[model samples]
Target: MSLMPDRKTIMLVLKDVTQENQYKREKLEQERKFIEQTRMAQMGEMISMIAHQWRQPLSSISATSMNMMIKIQLGEYNLETKEGRDECENSFVGQLEKIEIYTQNLTTTINDFRNFYKPNKLPVLTSLKSVVEKSLKIIEGSLHNDNINIIYDYNFNEKIELYDSELMQVVLNIFKNAQDNFKEKGIEKPLIKITTKERSLIICDNGGGIPEEIMKNIFDPYFSTKDEKNGTGLGLYMSKTIVEDHHKGSLHVDNQEAVEGEGIGACFTIKLNLSSQSMEG
Candidate 1:
């Protein structure tokens, strides 16, 4: 007979397998929840867009109907009054046409929303520049409010192929978090230096530096410094997930060189794979 394993050995092996499986299952569940939550938020934004699209059409319908009713009451709806009746008919028809255009806009918005909110989708190659612009727009108000200056150094010699939507989210999230942090610190003449090269992008902020002790732990999920009113702690975590897991990119951070009389800062570098068109690390 083959040598028999001890009961303790068997028990330890079973425990290890059980824990590994449980860890995987839990991670899968968290990913599921995260995707669902993001999709829901996007749906909310789309709903707002849908409403915005119909505003002009609905306004045109209401205004035209009121004016037509007024003309009828004033006995001005007669076709025999020279070209006056023809003019009124033409005006009403034009307003109705405006309404139809508005309605079509609303329908188009709904279609676009549906496409964006779909699941289990793979990304196609898109430009890095477009992602930068979209992220800048999202943080424009905050940047202005904080009096922080954004200087872009677009030195990329090659086009970066990326998933447009997800990369946009990653960049936007980083900018917003930096803006908020700097705003709280009351840093004057706050400067955000954005520099991009053929294979990497760097974002630096003059909002004082990240504490040395927490440097490595910054990427840990559910870890944040801001209070409940300010931070969800997921911004950086999600950013890492987007760049690393989704885009196969690499990201790292370091302390920015200090400027005399100005506070310290942190710089984040994101490296992209231009040749492979997808990050491997």
Candidate 2:
């Protein structure tokens, strides 16, 4: 017969186990709520971006339609003449093609957003280039509408073990922050440069840098430099958590400037491991 622990000892051990399980449950619940809230916030931003992107294309389509109608009403577009009819038909077809292109772009944007919001059950080997490109596609509309120029540098063709969508979320958050800063400060010639190294990426924007006073607390929950009307303050905090706590990576920020006082900008740097392993840890 095997000897077991005394009754009192067994009770104590069981109590500890129960407490630990309860703590884990509570932590899991909190994480679930946080993820949900963050997703909702991102969806709201996506809607705004879609509106900005759709507006120009929709306006072009409307103007094209009106022009065609006017031409027809004025008898300038004559179906009887091959040349005149061909000209009008070509113009209409061209506008329809443009509309189709824009519509396809919008559909792709929605798909990206939907894929990103899904839960990642396990880490997969994904290329950094693809991840960055996908993140850019989601926000390209907003960037274009704001007239901000994006410069991509560096190349990472190798794969990394990560939840790609989570990493994409971090990239999107940093990019949107830079964009917001540029618009808020009215920066002329706004530019965002993204460069990647073997296992890291640096995103910098020429929108002026974060103030030293608030830099330390930038990643703290509920700490926001933007006014309440513009920010919920969880973005950077969540990004940090995703990088450090979830992916076992590093996320840092610095003020980058070529000279003492010129081209001062905020730079966010992220580093990840290149190995494949269990993300559950």
lDDT, candidate 2, at 141: 82
The local distance difference test score of model 1 is 0.68
Model 1: per-residue lDDT, tens digit, 68-122? 7887788776678868878877877886787677678666655644544443265
- List the candidate 1 regions with Cα displacement exceeding 4 Å: 1-25, 35-120, 258-263, 274-281
Model 1 TM-score, 2 decimals: 0.61
Off by over 4 Å in 2: 1-15, 81-91, 258-263, 276-281
Task: In model 2, state the lDDT of residue 159.
Answer: 72
Cα lDDT for residue 120, candidate 1: 27
What lDDT does each candidate get? 0.68, 0.82
C-alpha lDDT of residue 27 in model 1: 95
